[model samples]
Target: MAGPLPDGDQAPVDGLLSLEEIKGSEARTFHAYVHIPFCKDICGYCDFNTYTATQLGSLKQSDYAASLISEIRFSAQALEQSKLLPRKFSTVFFGGGTPSLLPAADLIEILSSLEQTFGFTENAEITTEANPDTVTFEKFAALRQAGFNRVSIGMQSGVQSVLDTLERSHNPENVFKAFEIVKGLGFGTSLDLIFGAPGESLEQWRESLEAAIALEPDHLSAYSLIVEPGTKLARQIKSGELAEPDEDLQAEKYELTEQLLSAAGYTWYEISNWSKSESLQSDHNLAYWMGQDWWGYGPGAHSHLGSVRWWNQKHPLSYSKKLEDKISPAVGRELLSIDTAKLERVMLESRTSKGMSISDLEQLEAGAKSRIPQLIADGLIDGQLAIKGRLVLTLRGRLLADAVVRELTD
Candidate 1:
């Protein structure tokens, strides 16, 4: 179990504010995140707050759908009463263990509720995440009709052995089929690929990238395999059944990804996300790296209101039961001090093309600033990122993005 935070105890605030009160101070862009924790099957490597079909059961899934709509209604009522709905919303993201597993009717009802509760902007970037096995032309069409303009498909590899080793359900053909269907339907699409699985060769990793690019997706996201504590993958590593690629090898793969994607005309907008052009970037994710407010619902969903970050309970049944009992189901919450928030914003922005400013970093302690010189010398960051000057990561810097961010925060 995770230990207590730096602060000794967890305490609830006197009252929860309406969505308007939460978002009013942020002027950048208005966005929302909806978390769906249901999946047909659970991958062994996943550590997300999700469960398999047997664990969720059919009745529980139905109840979850209703509960989510109710949460939206409650939040919408709060926003309306406060008169704080923004004139426009830049993005709406439906993220999950496998959002695609939900039926078209269920998805349509959810979207309808959101449209009724908080109106969308004239041209909103609405996106949904799905695994290949769950995708279908009919469902894709229904999603488009329901206001989802973009779809993000997860395809970890182009090789069957890699998929089997990772315990991923989809094959390469499924990924290609899903891509073709989404493209034929004319929706902006993004593909996800994971590199450095145990026993995966550099040539195989390169093949995965080539396959993703061949699809000509509007956006692409690449991640290095990470073994989270408590995950099956972690246990496998501990038992000597699996081993991650060495740091030097992983760095080489990341460099190859950057070079290949950049050459393929994709802009490296964030450390792991690449887009075809300015318009193809994921606005909802940008809201996060830029430290903007967003509201979320469902099991294990997290939300940010200014410097306050909170997460809902993880168990689906418990989440629905709490909502049915008319009580907040949140399990954890944190209110960041201004200094901490500024430091986090700087660290996040530094990994992207938008860059971090010098003013943001100055808020850190003198010791933190003193430690940054070596990072600059190592090419992890370009000049001082004061609030006024935007300093972004160089290609070499992005390869060790997590390490750079950790040094700042730790």
Candidate 2:
């Protein structure tokens, strides 16, 4: 389970979208996200909306696919009724509490429904997140045949001690086997790594990086561990059972990550993401940063269209019940104002290697344009890129990304 949802206006039962909300929606690239909320075991550090077998009281894993399909059909109908121009899905990502835990047949069924509702673009990317221990060769083959072209494995760490501290149930060796399976199936492979665990040392982080690099994944995302409040990891640290992660040590590990991955020919696209080439970057993630339209379906899933943002009910039962009654599962929504939308665009685009356009920033406010020179002088943004009309972050800027955002937005 995760924390409470943010405050917002109540959503309509019919899931109707105002004309203002759907205006120009066709021009934006559309994507679909299916959130699987079931997990075999909950990680101590996880705060994502996820549930164990016992936690899901009335929701059976066997019937989960059917429920998701209903939402897909409902979404298509809502968009049609809104008179939003129909567009094929550019990418579909199945993320969650361990999407691989479901039967391959179930995953295939859900994806088939999406296609039948709204066809996919040519060579559109379809990806699913897998727990290394939960995937098999047969499963990968089935998924690949069903049009899932990518698999992101949750490798977490290469060291067993760090794995234990994180409460990850998968064996480290399973990661190697899983990687082999996906690669053999011709799926675009990605491995996710978490550094800065409480007990994790710099050397341990290095070993994890080296292990992942040796596997030669097409895309790799290495994220620093964040101990969200109310998580088991946070409680352990509070009780002195685990030492809190040191900020200085985390910085050192981040620098090492940039060094080794760069040496291996992986370019940093987003601050936390690296890829062997530009084509290998995760297009689904980029869609979000670029302010494109996407509908996230499942418990606690969030969706955005034009300037309107909404989230579904957090509990599986509540989400399923709403859909069962032929109603939208969304619990709340917020419509963004023009200025707020522009500010958000700057905030998100700033984290990417492509950088935000200076013209867009200048539109936010008068002082925003003037901040560029001082930012370059302070060694935060690239002076060369600024001269070319883009605000790109240097290494220091990446580390202090929040301050950089404040400098321009304030």
The best candidate by lDDT is: 2
lDDT of 2 by residue, 1-410 (tens): 25788789998988889898887688899999999998998999999999999998867999889889999999999988888888999999999989999999999999999999899999899999999999899988999999999999999999999999999988789999999999999999999999999989999999999999999999999999998999999999999999999988988998999999999999998899999999999999999999999999999999999779999999889998999999999999999888788878888999999998898788776679888899899899999998999999998898889899988888
Which candidate tops TM-score?
Answer: 2
TM-score of candidate 1 on Cα atoms, chains taken together: 0.90
True-structure lDDT of candidate 2: 0.92
Q: Candidate 1: list runs displaced more than 4 Å.
A: 1-15, 18-28, 57-59, 79-88, 363-374, 383-388, 406-410
Candidate 1, pairs of clashing residues:
357-385, 357-386, 358-385, 358-386, 358-387, 359-386, 359-387
Clashes of each: 7, 0
RMSD of each: 3.3, 1.0
Q: What is the lDDT of residue 37 in candidate 1?
A: 84
TM-score of each: 0.90, 0.99
